[model samples]
Structures are given as C-alpha cells and as structure tokens.
Target: MLATRLTALLGIRHPIVQGGMSWASSNAELALAVSEAGGLGVIAAGPMYPDDLRAAIARVRAGTRQPFAVNVPLYNKRAAEFLDIVLETGVPVIIASQGGPKAHIGRFKEAGVTWIQVTANPLHARKAEDAGVDAVIAVGGEAGGHPGPDEVGTLVLVRATVNAVTVPVIGAGGIADGAGIAAMLALGASGAQLGTRFLLTPESGLHAAYKDLVLNAGIGDTAIVGRGRSPIRMVKNAFSAEYEAAANRGADDAELDALFARSSLRQAAKDGDVAQGKVEAGQSAGLIDKLEPAGELVERLAREAEAALSGAASCIR
Candidate 1:
C-alpha cells in the first residue's frame, strides 16, 4: 500500500483525500465510496442543515467502518452548530476552513479527532500549525470555490507551506490525477486533496448540466471572479463573462458585489442553470473527460500515484 504520514494518521491505506465540495459532497454517497476505497472522504458541512449534517454523518458511518471527515467552514453562519455536530457525532476527522483554527482546534484535539486546517499560504499554514492543528491542507489559487485572493499557483504555494510548517501538509488546488498527487508528495506534502476530480465523479451531487459544462471545459476556460474580494475559480460561462466585462470597465466593489450576488453555486449545482449560475470547478476539469465511480477512482488514483512515483525515481539513475 502507498503510505505517508497522512495515511498513518488518518488510518487510510492511501494518502489521497477527497475535497469536500459543497453541494457536491453534501451527501454521504461520494464520501462513503471514497472512504470504503481506503481514502479520506470528507462530507462538506457548508451547505447542510444541522439535522442533515448529522444524517449524512450517520449514513457514512453505517455504510463503512473506514474513517471519514466533515469539512466545516468557520465563516458560515452555522459554523458553531456544525462544530457541535461534528463533536457530538464522534467524527474521526475535521477539515476546517475559512477561519482561524486556534479557538476550535483545542476541543477537537481533546475529543481525539484529527484536525486538518485549510490554509491558503505559508503565513496561514504557520498560524494553523501554531494553533495546534494536526495537519494543514494548502489551497492555491487554481482551486475551485474560495481559492484565496492571492492567485498563487499550486506548485509554489504548496511548496511554500511545506517549508513553513512542521506538521504534515496536504497539497490541494488544481490536482486532478495521480501524477499531480505524486508531484505534491515530491514537493514535501504528505498527501494531496482533489476537488474537481471528485466533483466529476458519478456520485457527486452536482446537476447533470453543471457536470457536463465542467467536463467540457479546457485548461484555460476557468475565470476568477472578484479580484480583491473573496474570489472563486469556476468554469467560464455567461455569469463569469458578465463579471469580467464589469471588472474590465472598472466597476466598483459595490457594483461587482451586486453582480456576484446574482449568481450562486446552488443555482448551477441544484437547478442545472449552467449558463447563468456559478458553475464552480477547477482547472483540473480539462484533465478529466469521463465520470468514474468514486470507489474505483480512488483505487485508480492510488495505483497511478504509485506508478508515477516509481517512474520518476527511475530518472534519478
């Protein structure tokens, strides 16, 4: 089995972790599938109600004896409630994002839960490590959803975070396959987390139209809306085009904010409004052409990563 510090800490056979994409992983199916395949599966608590989150956790527990995580964005209105549920449900791991971990990490540690903080840069990674996080997942600008406002590429950002922190680091953002995961490991990250790759899986909760659009996207097809504000990397569509036009014309923050508020990931993921909604996806969409079962994909990724690492080692001689 391919192993690393992350695999040992999380009790998984492989060091791969599925990114907890909202709407995409709001259900337990995808998380359960990945966990059963010996990867760390994360159920996103971002868009779920308290009861729904509990139910999702229960469903995953009932489906597999393997470990799984719940991603709780600390900036959400119900963040405290979500944390409560995570603690009460006895979840094995907590992948936290969008806020400082100093206040919350203590309790999770006390509960014997693994706390993996999501940081966007070296500074944040250092801060997370100082706050007692067991590990940190460094997200770069190429990631979908909120990929920080700095726009640093995954290679530079992940390597920077690895050098900045003493804890194990999981490199995220723009990773779509085994080669990418191997690259992260080579850069000193213990593992890699993939969002877009898992989002295109058959078990993802996105609308068919949303998946189709992402599946057809190219490497340069994604656009970043909101440069100074909280930014998101999504597939280029009408909504992004409109936003880009407004920004190009020097639209003020208020104007851009209003335009941004008009569309939502829920609109595209839930209603199939691919043309006018936030079809959130990463640059990795260009690398994925087909939808695979989450379980099978996890196994394939592990095998591919092993082969990639072995092949790269041959070059040393």
Candidate 2:
C-alpha cells in the first residue's frame, strides 16, 4: 500500500529501488529476491559482456515474474551492446546512468521499455525529461562509485531536480533506512534508490570482508577521491590513501588512470582485497550494521517508511 508515482509507473508495490552495483549486481539472486518482495531490483549491466548480460537477465526472469530493471552505465564502451541484449531479452525497464540518456532514450521508448535516467544535478534532470525519460534518479555526492562534480547533498538535490523536471524523481545517495525514504518523499521524490544499503544484504555477491568493512565504518569514514577524473566515494584504506595523495599532488589524468587501472573493483568485491582494491560505497555505510535477506530487508523498509510517515502525519492531528 506504499504506492507512489514510481511504484505506479514501475508496477511495484513499494517505492524502493536497489542500486546497480558493478560486480555486486552481476548475479540475479538479489535482484530476483527484491523484485519478488515488491521493490524494483536492478541488474548492473556495465561490467558484463553481451553474453553475460543476456544470461544474467535470463536468470532473473526465470527466477521471478515480477518487474525488474537493467542499469546500463551510458559511458561504458559496450553500453549499446548491453542495451541491445536487454531489449532482445525483453526486459521491462532500463535505468541509464553516468552519461546523457538522450541518444538511447528514444530507442528504449520505442521498445516499450520504461526508461529512467540517473542525474547528479538539475541540468541533467531537465535534459533527461527533454529526452523523453519516464523518470529521473537524482544522485548526490554521497553516492558510491562515480558521483557528479557538483557535490550536492541528497536532500537538496532531490528537491531541485523535482522542480526542474516533470518526470518522477527518485532520490539516491546516503539513504539507508525508512527515515531516509520518508525524508526523500517529503522532498518530492517519488522513490528512493539505495546502493550502499543493498550491498550488505545477505543475497549480495560482495565478499564478507568487504561487507565487514562497510559494517564497521562510520558516517565520515567514506572519502571522495580523484575529483579531476571521476569522484568516487569509498571506504578509506591504504589504496585510497595512495590514490588520494597522488591526486592531491596534481597527478594527471593519465596518472590517475594508471593508478586506478592497477586494480579492478571486482578484485575487492569478489576477492575481498581490502587493502589494494577499491571498495566503492556511499556515506550510507554508516547506517548498515547487519546482513539480512533482500526480501526481508525490502519488506522492512516499506513497513518502517509507512510507520514513520504515519507518525509524522499524526503530529498535526
């Protein structure tokens, strides 16, 4: 009964959407479980080849009949290929991030797919609406992976984007609980998308050590590095320290690329290389303390958000 514009448009019961993490979202179990729990689960199609993406989509479809989405980082070299595979596989929704959706939005609309664009600012939000996107996910600097250069907070970004676009807005970054979802809704967001919160779920494919790091981290433990290149929020470690130091000393883009190229995100997410590889997470890591099933977490989030909203409404009465 926690229906919103997002839930109505996506045909889901709850307005919660799990983020598309690179290595973590490659598998279908988490996505399937979340979708079955009445929230939209997104499979990250960035780190996968065409064949792998197709297989992942098939696995989720076979596991659950509920609606799910495929997130394609528009900047990825194989993004178009992944989109083709998703369309061919008959996926119902598409979430595009990290680049402009103008070129691909038309194709997704033509395929009768629900196209959602991820934006870091109002400018991008307006652009997405102009491109015919059904919705826009406003991501703030508190987000994991590559955040936008504006470095705006989620609360303010959500409201600004909502005013700039006619499409439904989903707030993302630093949101880990029912309180956060309620706050976003109050800010005019129709839904909330959480990457860091979902990363620690039991169904997530992330390594136990990485999850432990996330669980142990505090609110300010995350640091944004490589501003000139791609601003990324991750748990502080020896690897990040070195990377940050290099960037601070005026490292060129090539140098930054070389530094980052030394290790892959999968190395940390799958193999648990806490010291060397990057553990991309958001400021929301501070809110996660335990691991639970994706389905249970989804249900809990919905119930908690409902109760919180009801309590707030009772204050006026």
Candidate 3:
C-alpha cells in the first residue's frame, strides 16, 4: 500500500492521478477505468459545454463508485458556469488551472469541494497555496498542451514547489510508469499525475492514428511548438511545421488566425489527421507502447512502482 497524503485524502489505493487532457482524456470510459483501478481520474472539463460536462460526470459516476476530479480551466470565459454545473453534479473534487481570482477558491471552499491548482513554476504554486488550495500540481515543460519555458524539468519543478508550499504537491510532465511515480514520491511529491500515458490507453477516445503516434514515438520525437503565443508540445507534423513557420515569420493576428483556422484540433483528435491537425501530447509518448485497458494500466503501474521501490531498498542493504 503506497500510502501518501494524496492517496489518503482521495481514498485511492495508488498515489497516481491521471492528468486531464483537453479532448482526449475527458472521455467517460477512460475516467471510470482509472478510478476503478485505484487511481484518481480527472475529467477534462475545458473543451466541453456545461451540459456535456454534466453528462460526462454522470457517465463516470455511473461507471465507477470511486472518486474522481473535474478539471476546469480558470481562464475560460464560461468557467463560472462550468463550476456551477460541477457543483450541481455534487462532484467532490475540482482542479483549477490557468489562474483565477482568490474569491473563486473561497467559493469552492464554501461549497465543501476539494480544490487543486496546477502550476508550471514555484511562483504559481505559492500563489495557489495562498489562495487556499488543498494541493498544487506542478507541470514542467515536458508536459503536453501549454507548457511553460523549457528551462525547468519535472524533477526540479516538483522539488521547488514542494519546498515553496505547505500543501501537497502533485508532480506532472513526462511521467508514464511506476518508476516515474516512485521518483516523484522520492522527490517529496505526494502523488504523480499522467496525461500522455493515458492517451494511449485503449479506454481513451483519441483516434487510432493519434494513439499509434504515441505508441511509436521515440525519445525527443515530441517538440514544443508556438513557444511565444501558445507553447504546446506535440508530435511533429506538417501542420505543426506550418504553424511554427508562420509564428516565426511574425504573422499578424489575421494571418495567424487564418493559419490556425486552417487546422482543427478536434477534427484531428476525432478524425485522425496526423498531417493537418493539432495533436497535443507530452514527451512521455516515448514510454507508451500499446493501448491497454485503463484499469490494467493503473494496476500495472502500481505493481511496477512497488517492485522498483523494493529493488531500491534491497540495493541499499
């Protein structure tokens, strides 16, 4: 039993949490499977409307009796509405990202909901702590979607955040296996969060082509694109190249809009267009080899972490 503050707080058997992915990780089947496997599953609430989010939450609850979290981007215009829907659904945990007012944190506290905030640096972690968050998730540049500057890796970021805040730290970015989870715990994190690993799981709703890319990608195959405007890590392709070139050439707002308009993120995720769509994934893609059930993935990670920790102990003696 890998007990930690997070495991005890969330009532999970493992100290691993699934990172929320905008379009891919929000699916009900994957979320339920992760929870059933004894890890916390987070439903990505950013890309869905209020009704859709409620429905997804219902679906997850219907599938698993275990607790789960809903990730809401604080920067979204509809964040308040989404929060209301989440509260209405009686979801126990809500993860807020992208910075929100302190009053929002207080609101969640008043509602008796556990609030977690994601930070890319220690400064954000400190801010989240000050805002009364129950925990902070520190994501490094190796993460997918919008990562901060590439100067800090997950190890450094997690350690720094742990030092800066009294709240529990959930380490993210480039973590896929039990070895990674063990390392995070050793580094003072209460838990580990993963996104890329779950994207390749059979329960994920991502297109087969996208899943294949994750399974086949090697180390360094994932690149950070649009560093200045919308820094995102993804598999390199013609669409990414075009977007990067346009950003480099100083394309104006209209030009950039046209360039971005040509590519569709949802279409790519749903239709499997490797060449013309935006596929957000982390550098951890190299570690994923196959699409298995989410429950199997979670169970295997726990066993692997236990074995790794035991091996380390034996070596020390």
On lDDT, the leading prediction is 1
What TM-score fits each model?
0.99, 0.96, 0.94
Native-to-model Cα distance after best TM-score fit, residue 290 in candidate 3, in Å: 0.7
Quote the lDDT for 163 in model 1: 92
Stretches of candidate 2 above 4 Å error? 249-254
Q: Which stretches of candidate 1 lie over 4 Å from their true place?
A: none
Candidates in descending lDDT order: 1, 2, 3
lDDT at residue 87 of model 3 (Cα atoms): 84
Give lDDT tens digits, candidate 1, residues 211-272.
Answer: 99999999999999877887899999999999999999999989999999999999999999
Tens digit of per-residue lDDT, candidate 3, span 119-184: 889987898888788998999878887887654889899999999999889999989999999989
> What lDDT does the true structure give each of the candidates?
0.94, 0.89, 0.85
In order, what is each prediction's RMSD in angstroms?
Answer: 0.7, 1.4, 1.8
Largest TM-score belongs to which candidate?
1
